[model samples]
Structures are given as structure tokens and as C-alpha cells.
Target: MSKSSFQGTTRRGFLAGTAALIGAPAFATQPLPVQEVEVSQGYDPLRPPPVPEPPVRHNISSFQAKHWQPYFSNLHNGAILVDTQSRALHFWSEDYESHMLFPSSVPLSDEMTRRGRTSVVRKVKGPSWSPTPSMKKRNPEWPDYIPPGPDNPLGTHALYLGWKYYRIHGTHDTRKIGRRSSNGCIGLYNEHIAKLFERAKVGTQVLLI
Candidate 1:
């Protein structure tokens, strides 16, 4: 659940304090966007840093990431590793690798190369894409909101990440799998995203590493 924080100071105090003297907000007030972030990618099990800083179209000066953890997310066993830098998502154990390994998927079209790559974070069931204002501006053809369903850009399942506007989610465009595509969202096989979406939870740590 979310909380609220407040500083018991007034604008008068704000003007009186030095630039650095501003009071810190109360910690108890609101839920931190990343209440708990841990290293999940095998790259550095002890500590995983943010992944390749992917680029986007029609960028924004700032994005609102009030970041409320969803009711469910793509929470994974720490042993599983996901590297956004390599664009590969891996699952491993103490001894060996899982039979299935997800290689870095990049789009082949020039349209895809326009932006960089990203990682998979949380997964959602029947996700609905509430296209951002920028998304609508870029793709005027886009819908105001994509209702949760099979045909949605978010597909039957979605693996959301902490990117500006990117997510490695399920796609109705199955043919785009294993290739560079999408405005920014990573495309996964519908079946795969669906299966994985069932296993995650909100607050699960997601590493772009």
C-alpha cells in the first residue's frame, strides 16, 4: 500500500533556509518507488546495476514514476539472471543453466535500431496499454488506451521494466519475436510471456543488468 509524507515547515522556512538547508521530506509519508531493489541478474549477483540505457522516440524532459508496485509483478528467484545490456534474459541455478536461454533480441528493421534495448521487469495479465501523451503524439494512430486482451500491444501478458517507455512484454505481433521491432517495448512470444506472467509479483526486484 502507499503512504504519505509531510514536512512540518512553511514556505517562510523554505525561503529562510539555504539552498542545501531544505528539509528532507518525511520518510513515513509515501511508499518509495523502489521499496526494495536487489541484484537479480547473474552478471553480478552481489550487485546488478541498471542496464544499457536505451533510447526512445519523442522523449520527455521527465517521466512520472510514482511507481506503485502492481498487485503482481515478474518477481523471480534471485538465481534467475536478466541482462538488459545484453538484451538476454537468463534463468540459472547454483550449478547449471536452465535448458531454455533467452538470447538478446534486437529488431532487424531500421525502424527498430532507432532506439536502444531494455530489460524485462514485471509481468501483467491481460495488460492494458494506457498510451502516454508522447506515445499518442508520436503515433497519432495509437489508441488512447489499449484495453487488456490478446490483441493489445501489451498482449495477453506483459513483462514491464523500469525503462522510460520500454517493456519486454507479450505481443500480438508474434512475427516480431527475436527481432528488433516495436516503438520501444520488447516483443516476446505470446506463449512465453503468458507463462511467465503467471509467476511474478509486485515489488519483485527487476534488474536492467
Candidate 2:
């Protein structure tokens, strides 16, 4: 199959076929904390500003695979494992015995989702969107800046990876969670990304394979 076709098929297939994969329980042992913040304007040359939504409960377990048998022993505790082939992201517990694996969407093909070992360089809440140079070249109609809001592609939270311009972030559209739709960044459900943001700290090791 052609690379683009393979990517499109792989993303859909992984989401449909891997629902039973072992991981963390759908429900968390403890209640998630709540925080409130102000929204700010992002880059937008012509569009009106967007309206931000209040924080909501993150029922991540309902959409994630249960914690199952350990897989990568070489990885240290608190590491993140991105199985691009499986279209899933696994966050290891501090002991490395348990993990929470969330269904994910990757770049449409290998060229976009480059293999690498990196770390969480930074964390941004209500991150704004600025079209990358490549993005602008592909679609000149894209706005110069997008404010943080429901319409923002970055969703509620973003975990910036070590690679420049690459991130593990939330999506405004939940429907895209399991589809190969991004340029190269990892995409997760808004609630799932919020949950991950709370647990993932700067410098956390990330292995993308």
C-alpha cells in the first residue's frame, strides 16, 4: 500500500482493533483536581477571538486501555511510550509496573512521524496556535495565530516534546483522536490531554517508536 493510504488505514485499524489491549483501569483511583485560569488572545490576523470554556471533569479511564502487563523494561519510571504503529500513548507509573495507555492519532505517514527519543521540554496550559512555516506553505489561508479556546487546535493543554515544533497535545475535535490527521504532532482527546498534563512534568522521558 502507498504510505499515505497505509497511514490512514493504520490509524483507523489500530483504534478499532486495540480496544481490548491491557492498560490502566478505566477509572482513576483518585479524583482529578480542578484548576481555573484566564484565556488570552493568540495569533489571529483576521478572525475574531474565540471563547474559552470552563474546565470539565476528565473521565479519561472511559476512553483508555486498562493497565496491563509491563512491556518496555528498559524505559525508566515516569517515562512515556508512544507506539505509533498501535496509535497509542502509554504513560508509565512511577514504579514502571503499571501504565495508562490512551488511544492516539499520529502523522499520516512515517515521514511526518519521525522516530526519536525525546523528553517533555515544556508544558503549556491553554496553548495558542501559530502556523508553522511548513503549515503556511501548505495552506496559505491558515491564520497567523489562533487564540486559546474551544476552536483552538491545541485544545486545553499541550506537552511540548524535545523536537522543535512537535508536541503531544489535545484536539478541538474528538473525532480526530484515532485518525491520522496531524502534520506530525501527537493528538489526544481534550480530556485525556488535560489528564496527561497534570501527570506529565517537564523533563519526562518520551520514546516515540
Candidate 3:
């Protein structure tokens, strides 16, 4: 057969068939078997599965994953409260249960992309931090992986946000916390930040005053 004729049969035939099937009487074809759906915590098979959403990137660090165990290390258990004017962060025990992690104040900064100076920008679990252009230039010798241990420059754990590429994190540089001494990042004692890392969650309301 000629190419044109052949194309018509294949393409048109398929479309015709589709329309017929779709337009046929609802019961013209054999009835489909019906099954009941079982419910589960996070998934459902009976109904169409939900469309997945793209994941958001947090700028914390792998250093957060390994170094600190803040899951249960707070006076209030991993809740962050920041006083922007004072430049301090507080990690209190969560409301449900209780144990103070650290009540001592640590200076903070509003080096983020927010409109005005503020603290407690946002909270996330093990946030991810990508270095700023200037940071990479300054620390050209910085390593590929900020490793999951204490000595990592991201410190023991890191909560990174815009404020001039500043991160609220642990540091072997404990001396820097209550001071405005980061490349615009917040510096906490290596041990202290670790505690914050353990207790904080991805969306634990970060109150900034």
C-alpha cells in the first residue's frame, strides 16, 4: 500500500477505536470488579496517589547530620527563639515534654535577605547551606565536604539563612557566639549548636523578636 494510505489506517484506526471505546454505553463492556480501599498513615492505594511536590533545599549542612544530637538536647527541647536586636538565640524544650538545652544567650545577626533586621528567620531540621560567592572566594581552600563531624567549618550543626550568608551553627570557635564575628554568619560554641541541632525540627516556629 502507498505510505499515505498506510499512515491513515494506523493513525486513524487508533483514534477511531479510542473514541468508540470512550463513547460506548457505560455497561456495554464487562463491568469492572470493584475493590475496597484500605487506609494507611501516609499512603492510599484506592484513590489516585497525590502528585508529588518538588523538595525545598535547606542550607544547613552534612555537618548537622553527624555532629549534634539536638533531637533531645534542650531546656525546652529544640525550639529556637531569637532576639534580633540583642543578637541572641534560645533553644528551649518543646511544649510537649521538657528539658532545657541551653538558656545562655548567643549573639545573632539579620544578615539574611529579609526586609529589616530580625532574628529567628525560620527553622528547619538539618538545613542545607550553599556557600555565597564571596564566601567561596574567601575560603578558596575550603574542602568539598563539610563532613559530619565536630571540626567541620559549618560547625557541629548549621542553620543557614540569607543574613549576609550567615549561619546559626556550632563552632570549635565557641568564643565567637555572643559576638558579631562571622562572615555574617552566626557562630555558636561547637558544643552548644550541636545541642540545637538535635532538638530543632524542620518547621518548629522560629520566633524572632
Candidate 4:
């Protein structure tokens, strides 16, 4: 072939190879089309998605588990710590293998509050209720006796403390838990107190703080 013809052929081959290299990347890197979701009835394509409402929060800053060592000299016959500040109860079995924490209702005010150490002298299931003289004096209309049942304020179980007129017991009214709503006793939910009753014995060491 002639030199001019040869040069023209070479230039055509170079241009074809360069074009293929450039076009290959453009096609290879192309993005896939996004599939459209099926719209339900009343759906608005122009409207933004709904924002969810924030979760409701309760005042439970100190509602956490605690170790059983600091408050008790020993875990003899099991130990219970009632934290009035946190509105919680901590229990540890005599063996120290079982530990449980529960929300509690403390006394309504300083006058009704009792702090210090005590022991469970009695455990009564379906305990009867009677307002103390002071309680009745404060509220004359209060009932003199409440039989063991749903209406009883002592709830399903009661762990009578060493101190008179004091007990760690259950309450049928769930709203009282995790608050200061009791007279002089530490109160737990009926279900929680039932469980604690099974774990605690007659001589369980108790401390209220």
C-alpha cells in the first residue's frame, strides 16, 4: 500500500481504540435505576414522612441495681436495704448468690419516715390492715380494720419489721411504687413483694435509708 494510505489506516485504528477505552468506563460505571415503591391508598408522594413522638420519661434517676455489701454487716438470713433517696429496695440472699432490686414507695414526709436498721420479725401472707392511732387521728374517717383481700393496704404479703407499726409489704395500688406515698412502711408492688417474700425469711436484716 502507499505511505499516505498506510498513515490514514493507522490513525483510524488509534481513534477507534481510544473511543472504546473512553466509552467503556462511562457504560461500566453507570448506576442502576432505583426501583419505585408501591404507594398505598391515600399516600402522598409530595408529603414528607411523619416524625415519631418522643418517648415518655419517668423520674427514675436512681432506679438502678446496687451491691449488697455497704449497707449490711453480713447477709445472714438475707439482707434488705431500703433506699428512701432512690425509692428502691435491694435484697441479697444469705448465700449471696441471689440478688434482686425492686422499686418501692417510701413514707410521705419526714415525720412519717423511719431510718436506721431493723429486722423482719414476722412474715404474713394476706395480712389484715388497721390504721394506727396516729393514722386514725390524722384521718378520722379511715377504716378501723381492713380484712385480708384486695382492699387491704398491706397487699398480698407483709414482712413485719422489728419496729412497731413498721413493715416492708406489698401494695395493691401500683401507682404508689417508685414514689413517696406510704405512711411509715416501705411498699413494693404486690407481685414484687410476693417474690421478695419468698426470698426473705423471718429474720432478714432490714435497713432503711
Q: Please name the candidate that would achieve the greatest lDDT relative to the true structure.
A: 4
Q: What's the TM-score of every candidate structure?
A: 0.47, 0.66, 0.42, 0.71
Show model 4 residue runs off by greater than 4 Å.
1-59
**Residue 169 Cα positional deviation in candidate 3, in Å, after optimal superposition:** 1.3
RMSD of 1: 18.5
lDDT tens per residue, model 4, 1-209: 11111111122453453245445321132322322222122211211222221222224444444556678878899899898987778787887666666667788788889999989999999999888999888878788888998778888999999999999998766556555667788987777788889889988999998
RMSD of each: 18.5, 12.3, 24.9, 27.5
> Candidate 3, residues 1-209: lDDT per residue as tens digits?
11111111122443454245455332123322322222212211111222231222111111010111232243232355554444445444454333222212233234442332333344443444445676567666554344444344455466654354545665543334333444545555545565566666554444444
lDDT of 2 by residue, 2-82 (tens): 111112112234444443233322323332232222222233232222223232322323333423234344544367878
Distance from true position, residue 107, model 3, in Å?
Answer: 8.3
Using TM-score as the measure, the top candidate is 4
Ranking by TM-score: 4, 2, 1, 3
- Cα error, residue 178 of model 3, in Å, equals 1.4
**Window of ten residues with lowest summed lDDT in model 3:** 58-67
* Cα lDDT, model 3, residue 148: 47
Which candidate, 1 or 3, would have the higher lDDT against the true structure?
1
* The 10-residue segment with the lowest total lDDT in model 1: 58-67
Q: Rank the candidates by lDDT, best first.
A: 4, 2, 1, 3
